[model samples]
Every structure is written in structure tokens, then in C-alpha cells.
Target: MDLDFYKKQALQKQKEHKKFLDGLKKKPPKNLDYQVLETHEETFEEIDCLSCANCCKTTGPLYIEKDIERISKHLRMRQADFEAKFLRVDEDNDKVLQDLPCFFLNDDNTCSIYDVRPKACREYPHTDRKKIYQINNLTIKNTLICPATYVFVEKLRKALEK
Candidate 1:
């Protein structure tokens, strides 16, 4: 899928789409998780994340203590130094990146520290997980960031519409 095309489409439809997702959350189908898993699997098979790293480029994932430890160790930096240089405590009291376009994002839209990247980054888009209905708010927001998510939700909406 073309990034700009979906991005434009997402921008245009975000509000209505969010309402759709919210309603889905309120009255989730009995097979909600199964449908999401199937759609997510199919979406990811065709979409290459490297081609569109909008999640890494535009948003910062919450970095926990273990994420700090692993990433610091991988980068050969002291934990304190790493945190000081790259992180700040967000309003939610979560450790998030200090800047946008993520400091660790490479030019090719890959993560500079892929293996040691934060858990949230690894689980991004978060479409294929269990209890999918519980994260409707997040999934709605991700539609703006990830095209695959937009496609997944749109397809699922059609497949299981009430």
C-alpha cells in the first residue's frame, strides 16, 4: 500500500474511523480477537515495516526500566547516561523519547537498535494481540500512524459489521 495515499486517506477519515472503532469497542463481536488476529496476520504479510516506519518516526514508545537496561547495555552506555541523553519522563510518568523522529531511527526507517529496542516498539500497531477490544482507543490512534492498522481495522469493520 502507498504510504502517502493511506496517510491522506487516514487524515481525511480519522474522526469517523475513530467513532467506528469506539463503537466496535463498545459492542465487540464474539470473535473480535480471532478476527483481529487473522486480519493482522494477513496485513503484516503484505506490509513491510521498513518501508513505512511512521510509528518510530512520529511517536515515542514508553520505555521501561528493563528496556533501559537492555538498550543501554547494547549501546555500551551507562544506564543513567542513556536515560539522561535520550529519555524524559512524560506527563503519564512513563519514560519516553526526548524528541520526535526518534533518535534511534535510522535513515532507512529501521531502528538503530532493533534487537534492543523498547518492548513497545517491538509490539507496535499491537493489532494481533489477545483481548483486542480492550485497546480500542490505542488502535484507533494507531490508524493515523500505521497504514497496515488502517487497513486491518477497515477490513475487520466490513467483515464483522453489525
Candidate 2:
């Protein structure tokens, strides 16, 4: 995928997308969730995450306590030690990774601890989540970092227009 091209397109369309999403938030369609879920499924069928792990490369997932515990256990370390070594609290007061490109991201773009990865990582882009209109802000941000999100939003707009 041409990331530079995608970035340019996303930046150009940012305001338009945000406007559409804001409108969607005020009066979403009855089938909004269903359409978004279907669109999410179709988008993933065409896009391969392994080919472009941009989200992992550019952003950090918010690690909650359960995620910390799970990952700590998976790595055979105490939770405190894991937090000290890999996590820092952000301004949002959420625990996030210390680095981008994710410490666990392997050379092949696969996660070293995929099974024990944080919940936020698992639900990234979040287009398929219920009441997606509620997450318009997150979706807008993801469009810059995730081509799948950009495509999904475009597909969803088309789907809704019909």
C-alpha cells in the first residue's frame, strides 16, 4: 500500500469526513450499526492488516489493568515490573506503551504477544463496534493512521446514501 498517498488523501478529506460523522452522530440511521459492521467485514476481506500495520507503527493502545495482567503473565513478569519497563501514564491518565512501532511489533509486522495484546489494540479503528456514531472522533483520527478505516468510512457513506 502507498502510505504516503493514503495519508495525503486522508488529510485532504479530513474535514469532509468529520462533517459527515458529526451529522451521523446527531441522527444516525436505524441500521447504522449493521451497515458499519457489514462494511467493516467487507473492507477487511479486501485489506490485509499484516501488509500494513500502520496503527501499531504510529499509535499506542491504551492498556487497562486486565491487559497489563494478561501481558505480564504472558511474558512471565510481575505486573509492576511490566508497567515500569514498558508503560507510562499519559495525559489522559491512561496507561500506554512507552514507544511507537510498538515494542512487541516483530520485523514481519506481527505482534510478538498477539494473544495477550491490549483490548484497545484488538478493537482498533472500531468501525464495527456498536453505536459507531458515538466514536466519530476516534474514527476520524484513525483515518489518518489506518487505511482500512478510511476505506470503511467511505464505504459506509456510500452504503448509507443508497
Candidate 3:
């Protein structure tokens, strides 16, 4: 989607999310995991990530030691060299790309090192996972980055109201 479209959707989703959270706080429901997963599945059916790689273009995942080693090996470079060239330690002491539009993201929006990508990259959006209610903060962040997450929340709100 275009930047304008994304901006509009982001604003709308933000309002929806606040309303949904407020409603939940007033009358919380049981069996939230089933509700979230069902909504996620339905939303995923409609999302097309290839059309919008906003996350890869706007943010980087925290890279663990294993990710450093694996990705370094994939690039045929020493781990320290790889880290120096493409990453920096964040305030939390985790490795992340130096800037937005992660270095590994190709022009086509595909990961250049998909096989050895970080754990966080592998679990992005995190909507279909079990225990969805436990990561409500993550859901909020992902909703801002991933259209699928926005769609999931919208569907979830509908489901919860039923």
C-alpha cells in the first residue's frame, strides 16, 4: 500500500485498538486465546505480506548470539566483523541493525539471509501463536507495523463483542 494509505490505516487501527482495550477492561472475557487465534487465522487469510514489508523497511529485530553466528557464517564473515558492519548493540544490550530498512532486506522486500535470520524475525506478527493475551503489548506494537496484526485486532474485536 502507499504511504498515505498506511498512515490512514494506522490512525484508524490505533483508535480501534484503544476502544477494544477499553471494552475488554470493563468486561474481560475468558477463552481469549481461542478468540485471538481464530481472528488471526481469518485475518491472515486476507493479508498479503509481500505487498507490504513495512516492518522490514521500518524496524530491525533484536539478534541473539546464535543469530549473529549463523548469519555471520551465511555471509562468510567473522561474527564480530558481521556485527561491526551491519549491527549495533541497542540500549538493552541486544544487537539490532544500525538503521531502518534492515541491511538484510533486499530491494524486493525479501530477506537476503532468510535461512539464518533472527528468532524475532521468524516469530514476527506473533498473532497465530498460543497465549496471545499474554503479549498484549507486543500485539499493539505489531499492529502498528504489520497490516495482518491490525486486521487481526479488528477481527478479534468483532469476535469478542459477539
Candidate 4:
């Protein structure tokens, strides 16, 4: 999906969808996980993230210690050097990329550190996980950043309504 288009759509839909997601959290359907998994699978089938690495361009993964260590090792750099070069502490005190357009993101929209990327990067959009309600807030945020996630939630909203 296009970034500008998705941003507009997500901005318009967020209020209604947030209310709906809140209801799901309050009384989740038993088939919720299964439904979400199907949506996630189908969304990925049609969504090629390489075409639009908005997540890498606009935001970044939260780097855990393991991520730092693994990435440092992969690059043959000291952990402190890696942190100093690539990361900064965010408002939440979590280690995040130093700036937008993550340093490891190549111009071709490929991640330079995909294999050793952060846990958060690997599980992005987080739509198919069990106890999905637990991440409703995060999913709400993701809709603006990831179009496939927006589609998944919209599909989910329609399915539950029926």
C-alpha cells in the first residue's frame, strides 16, 4: 500500500477501529486467534514488504540487549560501539534506532541486518499471536505504519461484524 494513502485511511479509520478493538479486548471471541491467523497469512500472501519498507523508513524496531549483542557480533563490532553508532535510548528508555530511516536499511528497501534483526522487527504487526487483545494498542499504532496490518484489521472488523 502507498504510505500517503495508508496514512490517510488509517487516520480516518482509527477512531472507529480503536473502539471496535477495545470491545474485542473486553470480550474477545473464541475464534479470534484463528481468525487473526488466517488474516495474517492472507495479508502476507498479498503484501510484499520489500516494495514499501515504511516501517524501516518512518520508524524502527525496539532493540533488546540480545538484539544489540547479536547485531554487534554480526558486524564484528563491540557492543558499546554498535550502540554508540546505531542506537539511542528512547523516551521509554528502550533502545531504538538513532534516527528515522534505520541505518541498516539499504536504499533498495532491504534490511542490511535481517538475519540478526531485533525481535520486534521479526514480529512486527503482531497480528497472529495468541492473546491478541494484549497488543490491541500496538496494533492500532501499526495500522498507520503497515498497510497489510491495516487490511488485516479491517478484514477482521468486517468478519466479526458478520
Q: In order, what is each prediction's RMSD in angstroms? A: 2.0, 1.0, 2.3, 1.2
The number of the candidate with the highest lDDT is: 2
CA displacement after TM-score superposition, residue 160 of candidate 3 (Å) = 2.0
Best by TM-score: 2
Error of 4 at 95 (Å): 1.3
Residue-by-residue lDDT tens digits, candidate 3, 1-162? 664565568677786687676666566577776777778778877877777889899878998999998889988999989989999988998889998888778888788888888999988889877666567677777777787787787788778777
Greater TM-score among 1 and 2 belongs to 2
Candidate 2 lDDT by residue in tens digits, 1-162: 878877888899999999989988899899888888999999999889999999999899999999999999999999999999999999999999999879999999999999989999889879789888888888988999999999998898899889
Q: Name the candidate, 2 or 4, with the larger TM-score value.
A: 2
Displacement of the residue 46 alpha carbon in candidate 2, Å = 0.9
Question: What are the lDDT figures for the candidates, one per model?
Answer: 0.87, 0.91, 0.80, 0.90
Which residue runs does candidate 1 get wrong by more than 4 Å? none
Q: Compose the digit string of candidate 4's lDDT tens values, residues 1-162.
A: 578898889999999889989999999998998988988898889889999889888888899999989999999999999999989999999999888898889999998989998999899879889878888889999999999889888888988898
Candidates sorted by lDDT, descending order?
Answer: 2, 4, 1, 3
The candidates, ranked best first by TM-score, are 2, 4, 1, 3
For all predicted structures, in order, the TM-scores are 0.88, 0.96, 0.85, 0.95
> Relative to the unseen true structure, what is the C-alpha lDDT of residue 61 in candidate 1, on a scale of 0 to 100?
95
Judge candidate 3 at residue 135 and give its lDDT.
70
Checking candidate 1 for backbone clashes, the offending pairs are none
* Residue 110, model 2: Cα distance from true site in angstroms: 0.6
Clashing pairs in 3: none
